[model samples]
Target chain A: MAATSFQRILVALDGSDCSFRALDFACHIAKQYPGCTLVLVHVIDQRALETARMVHLQPMVEEIVRTLHAAGESLLAEAEAVPKRHQVSATTHLEQGIIAQRLLACAKEQGCDLIVIGSHGRTGLQRVLLGSVAHAVAQLAPEMVLIVREGAAASAGA
Target chain B: MLERILVPIDGSPPAAKATTLAIEVATRFKAEVRLVFVVDDSIHVLAEPSYVQPDYTFFADKMREEGEQVLAAAAKRFKDAGVKVTTQLRNGYVPAEIGASVKEFKTTLILMGTHGRTGWDRLVLGSVAQGVLATTDVPILLVRP
Candidate 1:
């Protein structure tokens, strides 16, 4: 039996509350494993941009995509700071594609042993329309996947 | 703050891998490990002919015995590793039982394996790991072998 040593971990961050919680959890694990490296990723959904382009002017769509990429870079920079706060350094990646596919590709390309993600815990129509990217990544990723939820029991009570 | 780690194991290779992973995590966190085997009788019901059937109790008893064996083998590994371990054999829907076990044990984390099923099989059978994730608030660490 292979032991769980998570030497390289990939964390998907989208600047959402839940994703930040996952980042915190990843940092904790990295702290626990002295040699562990955390890779923070932000994927810009190209499909969304394409849909925007179909409805809006080309220049407007290009501008929106550019702004989104800039936001992704800043998001990665902010997430990289998280691990540093815990005294653990992290690498960042900004990619454009389907969110789940990009995250899984990054994990495989980086040889990540584990992929950590935050669950939005969406239910009903929102879940069906948006779908759960974390769930998709969990289903497809070859590495171990950790799904983190924020607030714990306290939020459940609310 | 992970006081207990809950692991749901079937007699599959992936589950065995998950057990090993759970042990590694438990050792690192200094947490007790709780291994649960859920004997899902609903599958038997679905497979059986509606007209004629054998004693459900008898079949359930046999499944419980088999679950015990699987649990024993898994528990032995943890014991040999000198990790604090506990085991449970639950007879119910696999996902629901696991969710209840998490609450009853106050499990800080759930560690289990994902059966890498794709296409029709995954859609029709669904996944226990996904079900548990949907139903429970507990954090899950899924190992894919």
Candidate 2:
């Protein structure tokens, strides 16, 4: 039997309430494992950028891209607080691309054994449109994937 | 705050891996655990399209025996870990039965195995992982093989 250790965890955040919910669970779990490293990441959606480029002129497109990157950085920065409160230190990364794929690549690069992520709580109609990042990551990732939903956390109250 | 844990076992290698992970987590958190085996309802539908309708009694009896064996094997593993565990066997669609257990047990966490491999492997556990995600809002820890 292999002794499993969740030594390295990658938490994917998208600045949604659900993502923060995921961060909460990640922090809670990382707190249990001594020397466990937390890597926080927020990827700017590439599809969003494509839409911006198509709908605007070159100057506006460039402006939107910059704003997107800036927003991503701030999102990661903001997410850092939750881990700190849990007494867990985390490194944050802001990357622009496909959200789920980039998160999985980072997990591979970091040698992470676990990937903690949150699915948007809106499950019914939203699922029809396809492309939920958490679901995609869960499907694609070889590492262990934890899909945290609203009210699923221990701290969550009904 | 990890109060209760639910593990759905299918006797796959990934399921074994997930069970191992579940033991570790359940031990660490000192949480209650429910080991459930769901006999997928598809067996009844599949029995159709045959020249002869297979004995319904045989299918039910055979599936019950299989489900119990799966649950008992998993239960022993958890018991060996010094974690107290309860076993549950249900007959229904895999994901929906699991979702029902999550609600009935007030499960705080779910540990499951996803084969994510091709053909039969994918259908056995991989699709169930995705199916559970779609049906329930609970946090699921999916161990892949």
Per-candidate TM-scores read 0.88, 0.88
Report the C-alpha lDDT of model 2 over B8-109, residue by residue, as the tens digit.
887777778888888899888788899988887777776554635555656866888988998898899889988989999999888889989888888888
Candidate 1 local lDDT, B1-145, one digit each (tens): 4668999988887788888887777777788999999988675774466734654556777878988999999999999888999999998888899999998888878888776322243441137876787667777888866
Runs off by more than 4 Å, candidate 2: A1-4, A121-131, A151-156, B45-56, B116-125
Per-residue lDDT of model 1, residues A26-72, tens digit only: 88778778778998999998888888878866778878888998998
Per-candidate DockQ values are 0.48, 0.52
Q: What's the lDDT for residue B58 in model 2?
A: 68
For model 2 the local lDDT of residue A58 reads: 60
Docking class of 1: acceptable
Candidate 2: CAPRI quality band: medium
Q: Which pairs in model 1 have colliding backbones?
A: none
* RMSD, candidate 2, Å: 3.2
> Interface RMSD in Å per candidate, to 1 decimal?
4.1, 3.9
User: Which candidate has the top score in DockQ?
Assistant: 2
Superposing all C-alpha atoms, what RMSD in Å does each candidate have to the true structure?
A: 3.3, 3.2
